[model samples]
Target: MKKIQFILSFLLVGLLIACNSDGKNNSASSAAEIVVADKVLQNGTIETMNPDQPTAEAVAMKDGKIVFVGSNNNVKDFVGDNTEVIDLGGKYVTPGFIDAHTHVIASSFTTSGVNVQAAQSIDEMLAIIKEYSDKNPDLKVVQAVSYRPAALGRNPSAADLDKLGLDKPVVALGNSSHDGVFNTVALKLAKIDNNVKDNVPGVVYWERDASGNITGAAIETQWMQTYVDIGAWIPEIMVPETMNYMQGYLASQGVTSVLVPGVITPNFGISSEATRQDFEDIMKILTTRIESGEAKMRINTMPFMKLLDADPDDYVPFAVRMREKYNNDMLRVNSLKMHADGHYNDRAMSMSEPYNKDEGDDLPYLAPLAMSADVIHATIMKATSENINVVLHADGTRVIQTATNSIIASKKAYPEATTRHRMDHISFINPETAAQIMEYNIPLNATPIFTNAVENGKDGEAVLKKYSKETVERTMGLYMEMAQNGANVSLGGDPPGSVVEEAYPVWLFQQAMTLEQPGRPELGAFPQNRKPYTIDDALKSMTVNAAWQLQMEDKIGSIEVGKYADFAVFNKSLRDIKPENLVEEAKCVGTMLYGEYTHNDGM
Candidate 1:
């Protein structure tokens, strides 16, 4: 009996051992099944921008999406033999920057041509143009961009450009990009002579001398014709190369995405068959680049609404077709762009009151509205009904009110729709308008760089003289009021049209944080009522908030799991830098998109 009990005990022990071994094997298999990341960035201060987990020490990316954002100790599970591990060495990493509103094609044209952004005098600008023309003698058209008359003390006439002695046609685009001065040769080439009638009423016009001769200057819609003509002269191969270079340049500046607010259209003085064909060709080239992995940054474009002679109804189908054709992760075309008013400099922006008249100007100067409220309301309703977005370029208080009223009407009509319509360049706003913007949840794309120019640059004196001191002080930007009211306010540089200096996200952040111009730091604009944004607030404007404006918050805006591994690494931590040095000292070390370096500085 004793022998039998011992054998039974041994058999039971053997069964228990087998059960324990099976449990161990299953645990090991589960550990082995964990997927490894394609790339792991460790030992960095990651500013996740994810409200739930705002900071992390490590980030792991797999298949272009972030797989893990946590402590270094916990990231080992994602590491594998083939994974590229980058030791950040405690560098600061934040979500890639988003330029909410920019004219990429226009900016690229200027960047690739004679950039006269720093020309302080007309002579300097002419000299630069002459030099560029002489250097590129084979070119058919010589173009110079960012021609600010305020900086030159007066606007230049065609005669000024004629003195350059360039054999090729010369065109000098205004800082606004909606106006331009062309030499006699350029005018003749573009067929803009004294007999050219205003094609688009109240929108397109050519300035004339007292002698009834063409002044060589064109404004608004008329400028489009000049551009189209000049673009037609550019070599076909140069277009894509220039665009590719500009994309890489933007990535170097930490921009991963951009919203091109307007594309060339056949309307607005581009009615010629050749110009229209050129526009289509340029767009096709851009599309090919985006599809073939040449475009480094994601682009979201808004088609110009007033294309050719087509009315609002005619635009719906075209916009829908574009949306269907280019709606994807890298490119989107769901928005239609409209002009609500003109610029403040031209005294054409619709305001509540007349501008301060200059000496001998008897009549009060009230800017013209680009579109009436009724027209905007109808257009917005049409766009919203189709679930399409509309972005209106509204700068003045009256225009802002018009746009706000239109948005409110659209929301009332389509309460269940998710139309994220936006208003660009809300340069002037009051507390009442701010409240309305918040109430409707309309995105406010603020170009504070333009405000900076109005308050401190060459335009400051003119702006102060044109409007009442109270109006100038209280209504410029109103960024603080907009933010405090819980409005979705995002920053845009509006480059090429507003000088490249304004496009720098760091400079923009500095302006938002200080409200003080870099050139004039004595007093902040709107000192009494204006409050500066915190660094965090300013960062949000360029990152997630701007992404939200593009309707891409879930993908590229922040560092979080299941989001694209797009980040901009700075040489120094943004939090460690002094607020005043934010613009001058904050340097971008590298920019990454989809776990791969788009722009790197040897680190």
Candidate 2:
């Protein structure tokens, strides 16, 4: 039905253009030069996100662009006999939400596998895995995603997985998306045993039992390689289908645009080999969707490069080539993403101070930087010199500091460069670092859902048992603080790992405003500061600021004349809802992109 509507909308717009372009109908041309709208939405509360026209009651769209934005009385000029006038009945409308950083291809890989996120304990998880295997008796390796370490009493072990009574390998990806537990059969397939050497030693290695025997749990690069080697990922033949589902799901959440900062490649390590090919495959899928009018949202991707020691010359050109080749309205490549550190769990994040020391643990130490500052600076200089935006994933403060220094140096070296470097996951940035990030005009792409303490009320949670209370209060969520401090901040789910639900714009809005888990105010907003984002700023993060991050501020971020007719309609005004009731009261009912409804429940 959506496809049919999209096709009809395009055909109708094309017919209008054809009829108007030739000026063959003198009678129509001379009749007051009236401009006809393809569609007019009136009698609704609309937030344009445009400073000039902050609020409106109606809008008119033509040729996939907003032709009129004003009150209902003024919109009649564009309403013709043929225009599809939708009486909004006082519903609320805003610029379609833009997720500054998200994963489509990477999320597709995870969704192709079994999902065990709903299981609260090991026994229940085992039941799910057994049930999945039973349903697909001929499946090769069983791979499950969203395994919650907190919900389960402890990480499932290979020995525990033996109870499934299957000879096949089973791997459960941790919710962090950085680690996984491999059953013994998987270990045997990967030849990982007592003598298997660790990758990068402590930072990326397998868990071990007494006497140094491999315990089947792996972190960082090893588990990723294991999953790849055992063919646990989705087959290449199914990628297109998976990508479509992910795209449609995001559209249902009111998202019209997304910036996929990084996607996990097949090689799965800190190097640039095969990354371009991986991106090419993803682009092929998106290209097909756009050609067939099956694309629900516009995508801008940044090819991920994990340059540990490789020269910038090896990888920066690939990003440039991608930009030169795929510069279109629907899909484009503009940045090169790099990883600077790992997640904070297991003491992998490079922090200024060691995590809270636990008994029977190895001596506390800061995790070594994945890429030294010099290498990072050189990479940024080269990439920025080529006019490519460099997005650094820096979670820990120390890594954020390093990335900031590099960005500052790059900015100084090329002061006139128009590129916008991003600090992804600004998960734990201190005051000084935050100031530098704000001062340099660096953009921060934040994932608010991961900061909820109540939802993560399990063992190994970042704020609990790892960092000190003072640290949590001072540096944890500077989302609003940075925005208040003149930083360009945008919100995203960083999904498939950071977020369980894809359609969560309302949820993200709630988390950004209240900083508390949904329906669980008892958790008391984890950061301890309890600082909430202002309503306007929170809405901007989802709209205008996010459009700036995409480098499409002039095109589709807001509802304005000459801009794309993209909007998200909600059942109620987000402004009227209390911060705590946002999740319960507000919901996205329709998402329109380029004057076509991609998702419409009832609008």
Candidate topping TM-score: 2
lDDT of 2 by residue, 1-603 (tens): 999999998888766544432322211222244479999999999999887667888888898988777778767778888999999999999998898877776556655567887788899999999999999999898777777665674567888778898899888887757778888888888777788776667667787777677778887666777777777766465466556667677788788998888776545463467666777777887788889998888888877766454467877898899889889879989898887777666567778867887767688767887777777888899988998998888888898998889888888999898888888877788888887787778888888766666445522153566787777667777757888766889988777655436335777878888777777665567665747787887889979898998889999788877789999998989999998898788878899999899999889
lDDT tens digits, residue span 1-603, model 1: 999999998888765444322322211123333469899988999887777677888888899988777777667777999999999998999998898887765345544467786677889998888888888889877788777655676557899999988767777877767677888887777777778886444445676666778688776656666766755334454455446665676788788888887654423346433433444456676788766877787888766754235356866666777788778877788888887776665566778767898655678877656666676787899999998888998888888888888898889989997889998888788668778778778888887656665333543665666688788777876866677556788887776566555566777777777666555554345334467778788788878888888888889788877788898998888888777778778888888888778899955
How well does candidate 1 match the true structure in TM-score terms?
0.86
What is the Cα-based lDDT of residue 595 in candidate 2? 82
How many residue pairs clash per model? 1, 0
Q: How many backbone clashes does candidate 2 have?
A: 0
Off by over 4 Å in 2: 1-34, 134-136, 307-310, 359-363, 454-462, 499-503, 519-524
Candidate 2 has a TM-score of 0.90
Prediction 2 global C-alpha lDDT: 0.77
What is the RMSD of candidate 1?
6.9
Q: Give all TM-scores, in the order shown.
A: 0.86, 0.90
Best by the lDDT measure: 2
lDDT of 1 at 589: 83
